[model samples]
Target: TTQPPLDDESVYRIFNKLMLEGKVRAAVRFVTERGGGGVLHPSAQAEKRPPGVTLLDVLREKHPPQQQPCEEAFLPCDSLPPLIDVDITESTAERTIRSLSGSAGPTGGD
Candidate 1:
C-alpha cells in the first residue's frame, strides 16, 4: 500500500502532542522512523549526541537552544538541521518485493 506524505504541520502537531503527552520518547521514535525527508528530516548532527542523550538534547542541539521547563522544551530552532529529501523509488519497492517473494519466478507466489 502506498503511504500518504506527511506535511510539516502534521509533523509539528505530532511533535507537540508527543511532548505535551509526556511521550517524548515515543515522539523521538516516531521522528526517527517517519521523520526523514518526506517526513520530519531532522538534522543529521542530531544523531551525534550520546545514546543516553534525551530528546531534549537533540532538540537543543539541532534547533535554536532555549531555556524552558524540561518537559516543555524542544530542540532549538537554529540548531535544527535542514530536512533531507526522502525519495521512494519504484525500483526499491520492486527489489524488496522480489526478495520477499523468495523465488525468482513469474508467479511471484513463492
Candidate 2:
C-alpha cells in the first residue's frame, strides 16, 4: 500500500521544521548580502545556527499597532455633526487679542 502525497502546507511545515533544526542546509545555502551585493554560500567552516529572531518576531513587529502623538487624546466623536454649518453670530467671537496687539501671542519670539 502507498501513502498519499504530501500537500503544499505539509511540505512547507516540514521545510520550516527542518530549517529550525538547521537541517535544511541546501535551502539556507543562498545567503544574500544585506546591501544587495549577491548570494553566497555559508563558509565551509561555518557552524549551523538558528536565526537570531524567529518568524513570529518579524510578524509581531510588522503588525504592531502604530504609535501616533496625541493618539490617545483624539477620540472620534461620532455623535457630533459630520459637517459643520458655521454661523458667525452663533460662533463665539473671541478674536485672539494678542494678534491684534501684535505680540504674536504664544507663537512668536519675546
Candidate 3:
C-alpha cells in the first residue's frame, strides 16, 4: 500500500509520538532553533531538561487543565496571511482585471 502524503497532521502526530517516546530534544529542535531547552517568552522561565523527564511530560505537569486534543500542524507557507493589502484605486483594479481577462482566452469582441 502507498503511504499517505505527509501533510501537517501527519507531521504533528509523528512529532507527538516521538516526544512521548522520550525524544523531546529532537522534537523541540524541529520546531525551534534552540536545542535541548530554551526560553519560550521573555517573562517565562527558561526550559530545563531534567534527568529522565521529557518536555511533553513537563508541559502536561504544568498545564494539565489546559491540555488540548491534538490538531493538525502546518508549514508557515501553507496558510494565508492574517491580513491582506489591496490597492483600492478603481483605475488600477480595472486595469488589472482587464489584463487578466485578455490573457484568459479569446474574447467574443475579436
Candidate 4:
C-alpha cells in the first residue's frame, strides 16, 4: 500500500501534540524519507536564538522544563521546519503485514 505524504501542517500537529504531552527532548527529530526507499533523511534544525535566551529558556518560561528538554514547542510565531515525504518499500510493507497477521515466518511466534 502506498503511504500518503505527511504535509507540514500534519507534522506540526503531531510534534506540537508531543510537546504538549511533554515528550520531545532538546529538539524534535523530524525525519523524512524520499522515493519510498525506506530510508529516513532528517535535516531540519531549529533557527538560531537571540543572545541571552535559548529554546530551552523559552520552553522553561512556557512549560517549566520537565527533566528532558522539549524538542518542539510550536512557538507562537516561529516558522516550522520543512516536511519531507516518507516512502515504504514493498518488502517492508509485506513484513509489516506479516507481523500484524501474526505469521512470524521462521520465528514461529512472539
Question: What C-alpha lDDT, on a 0 to 100 scale, does residue 82 get in candidate 2?
Answer: 72
Estimate candidate 3's alpha-carbon lDDT, on a 0 to 1 scale.
Answer: 0.60
Tens-place lDDT per residue, model 2, 1-110, is 99796777876776677688876543343221122333334432223435465545555657978878686788877696579786765223445434332224444432
Q: Choose the strongest candidate by lDDT.
A: 1
CA RMSD (A), model 4: 20.3
Listed per candidate, the RMSD to the true structure in angstroms reads: 21.1, 25.6, 22.3, 20.3
Cα deviation of 63 in candidate 2 (Å)? Answer: 49
Across 7-100, the per-residue lDDT of candidate 1 in tens digits comes to 9899789888998998776688686774443222443434556666665567775788555679546655656678999887999877766655
Q: What is the C-alpha local distance difference test score of each model?
A: 0.66, 0.51, 0.60, 0.56
lDDT per residue for candidate 4 within 14-108, as digits (tens), equals 77886788655411544333213332233322247555565556655678645764768545666777898889999988887665522254344
Better of 1 and 2 by TM-score: 1
Tell me how far the alpha carbon of residue 96 in candidate 2 is from the true structure, in angstroms, after superposition.
81
Full candidate order by TM-score, most accurate first: 1, 4, 3, 2
Model 3, position 103, has a per-residue lDDT of 26
Off by over 4 Å in 4: 31-110
Error of 1 at 82 (Å): 47
